[model samples]
Target: MSRAWMSGRLFGAGVIGAAVVGAGLIVPGSALAATTCAAPPGAPAELTRVQDAEACGSTTDGTGGAWSLGAGGVGFADAVDGATVAAAGFDGGAGAGESRAGRLLAVGYGADSLALGMLDEPGIAVIVTGPASQAFVGDADDPVLCEGNLAAAFNLTAGSGCVLAGAFRYVTPSPL
Candidate 1:
């Protein structure tokens, strides 16, 4: 099966979440809830696309949490082809070691079907910026006979603040 993995890095303030679409298939809101975060009005949103399988396998370096993959939900795979196939943490807070005051959401996707294999699996990781971080994961209306995984991470900073992050992985049939 041919697998394609994509990672997105977003920096902001409020809630954080993710969504996945493959081969014209869409997972509804009921299935995958979006991550929410309070992004500054003029803060530049930096999105860097990581290509090359070798680069994806490299360690994700940052100031906050380290990178590691675990089993969650239905179709969660940690080490693929001897490489850690997963997304890294999102830096939201102001400075180094300075955590956010809200939730950080992450999402991952996986699949077994070849037609839908392009979507493959996604890895989600989150860091809380405030007092607490809450997470929710479910399937949308039109459900398919595929495996899915949903993982969440939250960091609670002092002073009535919350931070949240999550990820999703799903498996679908491939085109013959």
Candidate 2:
């Protein structure tokens, strides 16, 4: 559908753009008409995990919000079983505005499934910046985060290591 590709490194770990596209997580430049809210005035007008899920009637936890990604922004989205599930965007340049850390909640699907996906980028660790007890299982579907590779997720948590959010499967050992 006329996808515009990007090629670069993220967090100095793995390559961006191509990995997510190859994984078929998102169709770049696809219409986000499903989202009820207007795109933020950031560099790249796109939706995030919370926004798409909520707008498309996937979840209603009301965790959707926007963060300033200054310039050279990149966005990613995920769908499971033909339903739009999650999305996120990152600013490639110096970001603007306050940090939205701890604001976005790591939502899970029915029971065993989560609304997250792997970007197919090796060495790019998905760091969960929520409570200390917060943890996740990667694409390998490993029961623990240590055993599997840390898959990339959407993160609006500014000043954090990666812009992509973390947690494919929530594995909290304690209360948040």
Tens-place lDDT per residue, model 1, 1-176, is 22321121222122233222220132233223222222122322222223221111112112122122111111111222112222322211110111111122223322221111111122222321111222222122112222222222222111111212234332222224
Query: Tens digit of lDDT per residue, candidate 2, span 1-176?
Result: 22322222242234234333433342224333323222332233343333422322122122323322111222233222212223322212111111111222122211122223332212222322121122332322222232122232332111122222334443334222
Model 1 stretches astray by more than 4 angstroms: 1-43, 53-101, 107-176
Candidate 2 pairs with clashing backbones: 48-87, 49-87, 153-164, 153-165, 154-164, 154-165, 155-164, 155-165
Q: What Cα-based lDDT does every candidate model obtain?
A: 0.21, 0.26
Estimate candidate 2's alpha-carbon lDDT, on a 0 to 1 scale.
0.26
Off by over 4 Å in 2: 1-14, 23-33, 39-176
- Report clashes for each candidate as comma-separated counts: 68, 8
